[model samples]
Target: MISEFTRTAVPQLVGHELEFSKSQHEEKFHSLHEAESVIREELEELEEQAEVCRKLFEDLHSDTRQDDKDGAVINAKYLAGSAEYAAYEAIQLAAMCLKLVEMAGREDEV
Candidate 1:
């Protein structure tokens, strides 16, 4: 009786295993795709932010009055502002990447 049961159940078990594996594979693939999308979006955002910062810095630098006695002060202010913007942007990007990485790790575990 036991042998008869095994013979019937074994075939069904094999089919179930195959289906489960396929489902698992698809899930993993989808997860990886999502992670890639996140990376791509982050990269695009960073690039745009950098471009804006660069343009702003250039504009500020160019607007400095060359003949004015306060020209040095204007240039210094522009430099400081640019530096602060760049640092803030760097920190934001780092945080975004860190969160993405952590999320990916959690998904992988699941």
Candidate 2:
């Protein structure tokens, strides 16, 4: 009698376990997809900012007058300083992303 009851209950328990596993898998995929989408968007925005920084640096250097040595030198220094700050910020952002990737890899290993 006990053996018969165990055989009958085991199949139902297995079926429920399979359903729970499938649901968990689906949820994990959805979360991964969302995270990828967000990372892609952030990369696009960073690329745009990088372009702007490049252009600003180029324009500043090109606009510097060889004839007006004093004023041009001052202006160039100011523009270059601004460009340096922007580049530093971009570097910081890249570092943050790198740290995040490293953390995710560690989590996966666990």
Candidate 3:
């Protein structure tokens, strides 16, 4: 089941990604090939962030000391931050996909 936070947050993040991309790039995707390259790059970034989250989760599970509540809390917060970043990357990837769909639709109308 999807969490309420995710349902709302993902679309908002996708919109933010689109705005950021528009600001950073002078042109939108010119072709499906170009869009594929951009999507691939975003996927690589998402994979890297997911790996960071995975390592952090493993560390939190294995290294957290039962007596050191403060340290555990810190580790948990760090994990959450990394996970959030991964989610952000995912949103960017989704935005890229949406862009591809939009481009395809436009081509169809031509």
Candidate 4:
């Protein structure tokens, strides 16, 4: 009965479309948030690690961060690292959304 019902088909179609849109938007949002968070965390880590580098520089009386201006010029490095992690998280999110889409499609077929 369910397989032969047009009403059922209509709802599943609408649901799939809505889910596709919502999931895409949410996937982007999730990716953005994850990237932001990763950047923040990695920057903090780099700063902390730089401190260690600084300390090593200090113990040796070296000026490691001076020419770089407190790592001001290394934004690209941070983004590079952040982007690496971001892809993993974003891909996972996308896969999850696709799985949802696939499940919806399966239900629609039924």
Candidate 5:
């Protein structure tokens, strides 16, 4: 089941992505190929952020001293931010896929 936060947040993030895309680009994607390229780029960024979070998680677990652990806890907040950005990227990727379908006149099929 979807949580209330997800229900509220996903649409808001997607809307933001749509607005940002419009501001950044004068034209919609020219073709599926172009849309695919953009989607791949977003996916790459999401993957990179995931890697960052993984490294942070490993560091958080590996540290021994109370001071070091305290620092790791603070760094975990950075991990949370990275995860949020990754979610945004995922939403942006979804929005782009929807746009591609609409551009192809296949929204009805979806």
Candidate 6:
């Protein structure tokens, strides 16, 4: 009962189990691609934030003259690292969403 679209779209995520986003392409991306666009924008913003975190980290690490405030600097650096990691995870989520969009697009083309 598995159709070709499902077979193609879900293999990477579902393997050879022959599953699709829906029973039909019409059911596939009704709201899924919209979610993708939103997530992609969010991810891009996160990446930008991560870059800012990296810059802040450098500021915290440099300038030995600020040794008296090293604890504050260290805390800032750690917070930055956490933000960067969160951003990377968001980026990964965006990538996955994009993949779904591409799959949906391909289904549409068909």
| Per-model CA lDDT versus the true structure | 0.56, 0.55, 0.83, 0.49, 0.77, 0.59
lDDT, candidate 1, at 19? 51
Which has the higher TM-score value, candidate number 2 or candidate number 5? Answer: 5
Q: Which candidate has the highest TM-score of all?
A: 3
Clashes of each: 0, 0, 0, 0, 0, 0
Task: Tell me which of candidates 4 and 5 scores higher on lDDT.
Answer: 5
**Backbone collision tally, model 4:** 0
Q: Is candidate 1 or candidate 3 better by lDDT?
A: 3
Lowest summed lDDT across 10 adjacent residues in model 4 is found at: 56-65
Residue-wise lDDT of candidate 3 within 2-51, one digit each (tens)?
A: 99997898798898888788678733688779999999999999999988
Full-model lDDT, candidate 5:
0.77
Q: List the residue pairs that clash in candidate 4.
A: none
* Model 6: colliding residue pairs: none
> Residue 88 of model 2: what lDDT?
47
Better of 3 and 6 by lDDT: 3
Top of the candidates by lDDT: 3
Cα RMSD, each candidate: 21.6, 21.9, 2.2, 17.5, 3.4, 10.7
What are the runs in model 4 whose C-alpha is more than 4 Å off? 1-70, 73-75
* Candidate structures ordered by lDDT, highest first: 3, 5, 6, 1, 2, 4
lDDT of 4 by residue, 1-110 (tens): 54668656545554564466555654332443554564465456545555544444453332234555445435444545555554444444444445455545666798
**Candidate 3 weakest ten by summed lDDT:** 62-71
Better of 1 and 5 by TM-score: 5
User: How much is the lDDT of residue 4 in candidate 5?
Assistant: 100
Please report, as a residue range, the 10-residue window in candidate 2 with the lowest summed lDDT: 21-30
Clash pairs for candidate 1: none
Q: After the best TM-score superposition of candidate 2, give how far the Cα of residue 61 lies from its true spot, in angstroms.
A: 4.5
